[model samples]
Target: MKLILVVVLTTAIAAIGITLSLILSQRQAARDRALSIISGNKLQDATGKPSDKNDPNKRRAALARKLKESEQEEKDDKKKKEKGKSTMRELIQQAGFDFPVSYYYILSIVSAAAFTIGAFSLGFPRIVIAMISIIGFFGFPRLVLFLLTKRRQKKFLEDFADALEAMMRLLKAGMPMNEAVKMCAKEFEGPIGEEMSRIYELQKIGTPLGEAAVLVAKRMPIPEMRMFATGLLIQQQTGSSLSDILGNLAKVIRSRFQLKRKVKALSAEAKSSAGIIAAMPPLVALGLNTFNPGYIDIIFETRSGHIGLACFGLWMFTGMVIMWKMSNFKV
Candidate 1:
């Protein structure tokens, strides 16, 4: 029995040592392979590749990699477009416009018809009226939507800081987030209130705070709101001091709002100048028609005159756009 026990012990020891050695060797091999790759010494075919098959395989691999990259890029671009669409939809909602996505197309058709008719009635040639119609069809809706949405977004941003402050106070009082949002929805007015109402509905539907944050960020698409949502989500996930986090964020947002006001004050003159310049051409034409009655009648009476007016209008619009972009401050 003693001899049998000794034999068994010896065999167990041998097995353990073999397994340990194998594990150590494998770890060492892995480290070596990693080091080799890092040092730009990746292992190559040991059999000195069958040249023809090797080249073909390498080419195929490269092509596959490029195809994968292009596909990934396409997916990223598509995601960007979807993100833009979402923000644009939200902007329209904020502006109290119930227009469907198809509204732009319908408006474009109407605008084209209207511009064609108006220009033709003014004695413009068919070709000139057609060009103006095309421009109006493409541009009028975009311009109107842009101006309305920008104004609404500005109003929302102004009021949004107040909402954040209200929320911070409620949170500090130990009110639950959904309850705080509900209060804000009830007490606040305008775009911010409507947005909070949506949040309350989302919360009532049992959406997780993290996912809700992402949703709100997508809808609002503003830096302050996004920061607030991100803070809420992180606090939810990591169990942080919600009140303190929100309080600090609210302070920061208010400070940003003040800075924006100061910037607006400083840039007010430039913005006014840009606006006046943009308005000058139309205003001058209106004044000339009112005062002189037949001044620039040739512009509407002859084909050459029509061509000149169209060219001048195009250049004036381009200049207006450039001035507006330059005068505008993103913040």
Candidate 2:
């Protein structure tokens, strides 16, 4: 029994270690690529880009003023609901999934059943099995949903600047803003395309371009998307050069992306150290359990030992959260 338990624990640890290593390596590679790009090229000027406006400076200044007013409006609008949590339906929509809310409940039920079966097979106490079932039902599925939503948002941001540039091109070709958005809907793939298509549909049904943009921004709730929406609103109100505004917005988004990459690269050492520190307790416990199983059996057999283990786990989780919040920079 000890041998089997040791093997399972080792396998789980190895799997986690391998996954973390792969994630770190990927981030390093991306950082190197971003640094190379940053070193090789300069950020393009907004005014240097192709523009139909004869007086670029005047239009730029006018757009800047309009943006300031729009920013204030946005702040006012967000203040009322800044702390509100999204509903499950909103989360599903943000993740770009078409599934109904009932699907989530079904998944939770399945997960709970699986977890309960596993705990029973392992001969855990009834109370312990119930707790695990509750976690599987309420915690695991919700966590997965949040992760999916975040990943979708990240993918959307990756393609968003390109989408904006494409829109600029279409706009410069003398297409109206709504028509350019419609063209982008067909041109791009994935999240950007789906969002653009939604915007186009909204516009087709008589929603104003600015209103359609706002809907997309509200759905995404990312800074880049919000900026795009704000620019559209400003353009609609002031008749500013939409192409130039989009061009500049794309540049800004790219710059922010590069900065985020640089920050991630710089923080790699700290992240590595944190990972090592976090693994130490588990590794040590595993070693002790392997060589002297009696010493660790108390943790599994006694009520006090169980409480101690629970407290240790709670503290470890708290520490991990604190470290994550500290290391996480919102770029």
Candidate 3:
């Protein structure tokens, strides 16, 4: 009994010593955790190395970087959207339409409404009227704009060559670069003078010559204008004979114009053939309707007839588009 009591007492003291050591280690660990949080440092492990995986500071920094990147991406997306929107507006402006976009929308709506009423008054079915209205609203406006834009671009191209020639002449006469541009603007008429005056005005406002050239190039988007702008900027940056460069560019422009005319002349027969093919069915139907009343009325008079006409129209448009594409030859 006395030996058992001695062993029990020794075991109790050992257990107490172990418990005290554990409590002291727990308190030390708590103090270390507090200091780590305060100093913005990672908690060190038993090997005396910082554990980045479990570090709050590192996690916070990573999150901050991600947030910054996301913000930058949003800004870039916004810029792209704005640029696209502005590009369309610029095209409309370049086409010489000074009206607001809302004007076109209102015009389209009014046109659709008027066409629907007109078609209904002509005893057309609802589906036929709908088709007519859609064509009036969308197709007509687009066709008009397309024609106008092409005409304006053609006029610009014709005048641009002359302007380049005039610039070369002025440069040969020993006029300063800016003065030469001003003289060209005053000497020309139509789109060339207008565009050159715009460039001169931009220069007056302290826009750099290269930036001004780039702006006009983007506005017109013609290869000759782009080449001219690039050549001028390059020659301005390096020492080069401005007159010689302008004269060569003018010659190239005239050659390209001549080539374009030749191509158009060569393709005229194909274009005329396609147009005749596309127009034959409608023209024949009109002739038949005139000679034999109600002969073509079945096309839009009954539901089956409406469906047939729809399919026929679709195929006819497809064939016409194919022929048009085949007739086109790029320079």
- Please write out the lDDT profile of model 2 over residues 232-330, one tens digit for every residue: 775675555678778888997888888888989988888888889899999999999899878888888987677667657755765665566557666
lDDT-based ranking: 2, 3, 1
Count of clashes in candidate 3: 0
Q: Choose 1 or 2, whichever is better by TM-score.
A: 2
| Cα distance off (Å), candidate 1, residue 206 | 1.9
TM-score versus the correct structure, for each prediction? 0.60, 0.72, 0.64
Cα RMSD, each candidate? 26.6, 10.1, 28.3
User: What lDDT tens digits, residue by residue, belong to model 1 across residues 1-331?
Assistant: 5664575556556655655665566656644542332233112233654344334445345434533543574477479777775544555564557677677678789998998889989999888988999888977766777787667668888887678778888987889988988999999887788778888888889997656765765555565765676556545544545666666776776776797788878878988988888788889999999999999899999876876676576556556555654555444
Off by over 4 Å in 2: 1-86, 296-315
lDDT of 1: 0.68
Rank ordering of all candidates by TM-score, starting from the highest: 2, 3, 1
Q: TM-score: which candidate is best?
A: 2
lDDT of candidate model 2 versus the reference = 0.76
